[model samples]
Target chain A: MASSKAQAGQTLWAKMPKANAELFALTYGSLVTELVRDYEDPIEVNAQLERIGHSIGVRCVDELLSKADSSNLGSAVTQCGNLRDTAEVVSKVGFRMFLGIQAEVGGYSQDQRSFSIYLQENPLSTFVELPTIGDEQSSSSPSGGLDDLRKLKYSNLYCGVIRGALEMVNLKVECTIVRDTLKGDELNEIRVELKEVLSDGAGDDYKEE
Target chain B: MTVHAIHIFDRKGKTLFTKRYTTTKQQLMQDAEQVSEQRKLIFGMLFSLRELVGSLTPEGGSPALQSVKTGAGTLHCYETISGLRIALYTNNNPVMNTLPGARAAGGESTSITSFQTALKYIYSEIWVECVVRSPLYRPEDIQVDPLEGRDNNAGRFDIKSTNFEVKLDAYLSSMPWFR
Candidate 1:
């Protein structure tokens, strides 16, 4: 299962139109900085970034589905059966196809309702670091020096993207950044918890004669 | 072989587009209300049938309903991962599977797979091009209740765009079994 999907992701990544990686990373960094400046509050900036990512995710899903099945055999629908499959698609196919990066899926909860995606290489954060306030940094060193860095999830946009994309496929999920490399964690991990499987809204009111 | 009709439904079981051919069997319904009622019945039946199929499958995977054959006709369905469903109604006695020698070698399954492939092509190539990628198309508008008795074109959405209609007709007509 893993090898086939990884191969599929690699092929798709190869087929996708190329973009400059540095330029892409810098653009995202600029956007986040602008958001921080505009929002002032770290929490608000994170929320705004997520909102932007959510809209992107909504559209991204269609593009992913269309491209994933280059064979166009309508097999894309049957690929992801449950939460496990969804995670594999998102981490393997989704990340590689879009970002040209491989994300590992691990840390699955016993119930199978939740899982974590670990990003060993986060392109968006390659050139980003939380700026510390002068003097306040020295005084607040004991209090975890950079309070904003603690609150601001620099790559929180990924959480929203995952949530929105899964929702489009009728899987309502909650994504939280459990660990961030920007915050000195070894890896960037996003925990996804399945909240519900939305009914297709095939209205029960419709009665067949 | 005769392609009788086609129906496209969104994930919400709302009919996005419907077209019927082969009216020789019966006159087309003149009443818009009657046509919509028929669409509703078809969607409801498909929804329940899918659930039934899902329950019967031991593996309990996604609801896989490839086709439903009745004395009248056969319904071939292909659902994208996004829940966009394309269903085609064709005559039960498909000419492609009737070759005497081919029947011994599982020709029926081959024909069904081919039909599904055709449906997928319609979706990924035609629908995605003319509708999903169209700048004027609005995905949000699909939520509006057509049963609310709004304008005649309210429920039609962007799928009825001239470009989509032309492309769909061309593709369907190109099929070997389309009559």
Candidate 2:
């Protein structure tokens, strides 16, 4: 009986190890691609890339500390309270490190009355490449191409890192990436907007939920 | 750490020219010798009478003898005679994202009639290293191969000049670095 339990534990560990490795690889690869597509100079690009990743690490460390509340873990283990905290930590650290950037705390819509953060930059703007084909010409225009691009699904690789790090903290929060035109510096602002979906208390509904 | 130079290669395996920094000092005597060799080779490859000299000059002293430094992270640029350009930059600065589409089109390639006007952009921004272009011919000519020889790499692409509408593959393939 003891050996059977041990075998089950080992199988569980083996099954998850590959998934975690794949996630790490994907996160690192995407981070590199995003950097390459955006920057021209390698030195500045590489330095900023590492700095951003480092900032993620630093914030993740703090999040782990608070969530785990284990003194023994010390600085050796990285943690976070949840995916939301992880995203918040990354965004905060990245802003502070680059462009001397910062975000302002604000309340949600006049009716919602929820809390949120707002990024501010004047010269900063998001970059969107216009398609070379026909009808796409107006895409470069402020309202035409650029606006549509802004609404496209944002791939927040940093948020993925935050999510992965927070998993270490045993915290999971569904995260979304939202873009705000108000944020400048062409900065790719990552908003960890959280959501909660309520479902009927049935096992069948739980799967759909 | 200080960066002394950046070497860039295009999709055609051609070496655009190396961007030599004339300001920073060479760290060791061995490194100084390497720079001297590179300088001689660059001087021999001069194509046009109006050589676009890119120099990083020190505030004082002869720029030629200044120290050239190498560090873990720094940006570098290399340009092809046919107007193909590649740059490698440190991954840390937020400004890196601003250079790809419009900012990189700094009028250098305006006169190159034969070259395609396709822009090839690539980077590992999280690590601060990347490459960008103004514009080029054929959208398909630009490729970002993975560091690993894996097929399932998500972000990597295989851009070729033949994939473009214009044909600058021969010119690009004949670059100094390609040899």
Candidate 3:
């Protein structure tokens, strides 16, 4: 099953439209820099990035659905039987098709309500490093301090993207950046918890006869 | 084979678009109320039938409603992963229904697979292109037209683009059962 999903992701990645990775990275970096400068708080900048990502995610999901169909992946890409399937698709196919990167799904909770996505390489943070002030450990500093460096989530946009895309498919999920390579972690990880599965009310009016 | 109409519905059972190929004067003269009522009735029946079929199937998979045949006509259904349902209503051939063995007598039998393929083609090729990709199309916004207020559920957000209508008509007219 893992191999098949990986193969699917590879095939989709090949078919995807290509863009200059450097330019994309630089543009995202400039946007984050501007947000940090304007907001003057790393936490607020994270929230703003997520808001922007939510709008992008809502529109990208439709494109993803149509692209999946056009790629001839058929039912495999469309119908996700369980949360595990959804996670695998999001990591292997979703990330690959969108960002042209491979991510692994692991760390499933015992209740099967949540899982973690481990991304070895984040395209958004290719040339990014959290700036730290040497010997200035003051907590009162509004910007550029070791304290603010730890609070900044460089790739929080991915969390919002996952949340918004899943909501469109009636899966209400909460995604958070649990681990970041920018924060000295070996890999970046996004933790996703299934909050609720929205009912489309198809059987609401059905009366037993 | 004669196609009477085509209807598309969103996941919540709201009518997105309904195109009736009015052949006779009787059908052409169907009032707005009658048409809207018919759309609601068809959707209700489909929803109930789908649930019934899903429950009755021995296999542990969703068995969606494929077709419904009556004395007058037949209804073929195809639903996408996004929960969009597209139904085609066509006149049934009396000769084939009377003698099941005579289905092979004609080379042009309206098999379920062919209809399913056609419906999927309409979805992936026509509907996705014309309606989904259009910048002006907003699926969630409900229009406040007083004329369609009689049936609130009939026209929530219709595919009212002239380009979409022209393409859909052209594709359906090219089908074998259109006439």
Best by DockQ: 1
TM-score to true structure, per model = 0.80, 0.24, 0.78
- Candidate 3 per-residue lDDT over residues A124-177, each given as its tens digit: 998997766553665544556555756888899998899877877889898899
lDDT of 2 at A168: 28
lDDT of 1: 0.76
lDDT of every predicted structure (CA atoms): 0.76, 0.33, 0.76
For model 1 the local lDDT of residue A111 reads 95
**Candidate 1's residue-wise lDDT over A100-198, tens digit each?**
898999888999999999999998898777655544545423333345646888898999899878888989999889999887899999999999998
Q: Candidate 2, residues B80-108: lDDT per residue as tens digits?
A: 22122344332222122233354344445
Runs in model 3 deviating more than 4 A are: A30-45, A70-72, A133-152, A202-209, B23-34, B93-110, B136-139, B142-162
Cα displacement (angstroms), candidate 2, residue A121, comes to 3.5
Which 10-residue span in candidate 1 chain B carries the lowest summed lDDT? Answer: B97-106
Clash totals for all candidate models: 0, 69, 0
Candidate 1 local lDDT, B49-118, one digit each (tens) = 8778878878745567899999988999987778788889998867652435634544455678778768
Residues forming the 10-long window of minimal summed lDDT in candidate 2 chain B: B121-130
User: In model 2, what is chain B's TM-score?
Assistant: 0.22
**Model number with the top TM-score:** 1
